[model samples]
Target: MGEVKVVFQSVDEVMDYLKALEGYSGDLDLQCDHMIVDGKSLLGILSLGVNRLLNLQIYSDNYEELIKKIEFCCRG
Candidate 1:
């Protein structure tokens, strides 16, 4: 398991991240307050009310690449 901290600026970025994550075969988890959702779910991510200081956990052999892709959204 790997953990990364990131902030989402908009819904579009989140959608992009989700799209990129479609290629990853891993268990990705995003947590905000007490809510936990799949990192690959656009609807699930949007419902978190994520704005800043969101911690994402990418679990799998490809976690390093997944983290990089998700970090891409922080800039968007």
Candidate 2:
């Protein structure tokens, strides 16, 4: 497993980030406070109340691709 720290400027950015990761072959989880939610789940992400910094854990075989994609999405 690998980790990356990201921050979303707005609710729309969070939603868009999740949307862009659609069809990714591995598991992704984002944590904030004490909450952990599925990165691929828009509803779960929205429920995360994400604003500002979020910590992400990428549990995937292709850690490089997952990190790259996540970084691209959350880059603002």
Candidate 3:
């Protein structure tokens, strides 16, 4: 699994992030504290709240491309 911390600035950013995930075939998860949800689900992401650093667990080895595409939302 690949892990990276990210934060969404707005609903629109979340939508864009989801769109980026569509290209990946492997399972993905979003973790906030002890809670974990499917990264592909808008409701799951919304439930985690926006503008907060959340861990993105991409279940794939070839996730660099997706990461590059979502650089705008990554928590530096």
Candidate 4:
């Protein structure tokens, strides 16, 4: 699994991120505190909230494209 800390600047970006994730057929999850949601789902991502640190877990070995799409959102 690949893990990264991410922060969404706005709802639009979250939508874009999800769109980018759509091409991948893998399990991706976003976790904030105790809440965890599917990375590819807009509603699920929104539930984790925005502008906060989120732990993104990428379950696929082939995640270069997905990572590239959200690299800007990475926190440090």
For residues 11-76, what per-residue lDDT tens digits would candidate 2 score against the true structure?
788766877677877788888888988877878877777564677787876777766766754533
Q: Rate the local accuracy (lDDT) of all candidates.
A: 0.74, 0.74, 0.90, 0.83
Q: Which 10 successive residues of model 4 have the least lDDT summed?
A: 15-24
Q: Can you write out model 4's per-residue Cα lDDT over 1-76, one digit (the tens) per residue?
A: 6888899999988877777666688898899989999878888988778898999999988766668877878885
Q: Which 10-residue window of candidate 1 scores lowest in summed lDDT?
A: 67-76
* TM-score of every candidate relative to the true structure: 0.82, 0.77, 0.92, 0.88
On TM-score, the leading prediction is 3
Question: Tens digit of lDDT per residue, candidate 3, span 1-76?
Answer: 6888999999999999988777578888999999999989999999999989999988898878778989989985
Best by lDDT: 3
Clash pairs, candidate 2, are none
Model 1 TM-score, 2 decimals: 0.82
Which segments of model 2 are wrong by more than 4 Å? Answer: 73-76
Off by over 4 Å in 4: none
Q: Evaluate residue 53 in candidate 2 and report its C-alpha lDDT on the 0 to 100 scale.
A: 65
lDDT of 1 by residue, 1-76 (tens): 8888767788777777778777678787878888888877777788887576667887776677766666675432
TM-score of candidate 4 relative to the true fold: 0.88
